[model samples]
Target: MDPKVITYYFADDGRIPNHPSLPLILYPGALKEKSDRIESIFNENNWRNSWTNGVFDYHHYHSNAHEVLGVQSGSATLQAGGEQGTALSVQAGDVIVLPAGTGHKRLNASPDFKVVGAYPNGMNYNLRRGEIGERPQALEEIGKVPLPETDPVYGTEGPLIELWKHKERD
Candidate 1:
């Protein structure tokens, strides 16, 4: 099925300089009851280093890698971008693609809320909570991240590939 895609952009928030070539991409009800399928899709597209869990309850971002989170069960309200970011309501089968340096947090969640998360190229990630001291290193690392060769859910072509490539040209 062609999933509904939504995108969000954030400016440099002093602490977290959200990516210029990437935006937060959300695919609602993309996984549905098939949330377990996320691993296979992510793996096939080179998004390795998988984990199953819920999002953090506090604001944070990763500078070392881009991340993809597939909602396996339950629902939650998530804050993305930064302090001035937008809040999103997510449920089972939903998927969120976070570019390196994009901040995110779990504002609230259902008891059964769970997610499958992974990174492109099996990248190891470091968490930063918008600390002023973390800005320099985070910015450097974020700038070094390469665009993924494939979309986490849509293989080599999809909204992610199309949008990110277009952003690069702008």
Candidate 2:
């Protein structure tokens, strides 16, 4: 009596059951769960400004996303895969389980980091949408990459992104 020994429990997005590009879709009710004009929930998304100099620019990977970051104020460092500089100093609630290829970065940015993210996917966008053969050699190495220090919180006159360059001739 062994019908191929059936035993199924497919849910290891990150660990136990919470990884599919950070998925755990649920919304019930509890401590002030008021719905109306605001509910973008990716831990109340608003932490834009990520980088990687040398024209490398956001190298990606994710076989089944599961990004969970919860830091209620300042502190970030998440560089995965390459491990050239080594980063992973997450703070606050600190509930990590970032599986998949694990290549993320949001390092050293704190005017109060403030985070709360929960992802649990099984529908789509565990993104790896390819079509980039390093467009023109990564825009000729991001036009000879530069800018490592000058970060007075954007006052450093940094991000003016527009690689893929080659503009000469009057």
Candidate 3:
């Protein structure tokens, strides 16, 4: 069955410098079985350099590449976009794809909460804390960051490719 997808667009909130066009993608219960092999699945789709860990309590974002995080176990409430963004509750088997420059932070999680994260094309990632004097560069890099050729969860054609239409940025 095709996975159900939910999309969210975050504005440039000054501090976070969220992506202007791409909406964050969510796939609830997308990896119901074999959640333990999320990293392998991601790598298979060309989203590489996988890592397993818990989300940071403090808000942070990547400016160099898009990110995909799959819930390996347990559950958590993750704050997305920025301080003004929404609080999303995710659980095991859920997948979240964040475009470059989107802010995210962990509000709370279960004791065993763990997630597997990967980047498109094994792109090198850079961490940003929505600090002062970071918006200009972050925005620039975000615009130049290319879209992934395949969805981390679905491969060549999926909700990601359909929803993330490339747009020209100023």
Predicted structure with the largest lDDT when compared to the true one: 3
- Give TM-scores for every candidate, taking all chains together and pairing residue i with residue i: 0.94, 0.23, 0.96
Per-residue lDDT of candidate 1, residues 125-170 (tens digit): 8898998888888888988888888889888876788878766612
Q: Return the lDDT, model 3, position 98.
A: 98
**Candidate 2 wrong stretches, greater than 4 Å:** 1-40, 43-62, 66-71, 85-100, 104-115, 120-170
Which sections of candidate 1 miss by over 4 Å?
Answer: none
Cα lDDT tens digits for candidate 3, 26-106: 999999797988999999999998899999998899999999999999999999999999999999999999999999999
Residue 97, model 3: Cα distance from true site in angstroms: 0.2
Kindly provide the TM-score of model 1 when superposed on the true structure, using C-alpha atoms.
0.94
Alpha-carbon deviation at 97 in model 2, angstroms: 14
Which 10-residue window of candidate 2 scores lowest in summed lDDT?
1-10
lDDT per residue for candidate 2 within 45-146, as digits (tens), equals 321122112111353434433333334444466554433423556544332334333345565655555554433322122333122552333223323323
> RMSD per prediction, one decimal?
1.6, 19.3, 1.1
Q: 140, model 1: CA deviation in Å?
A: 1.0
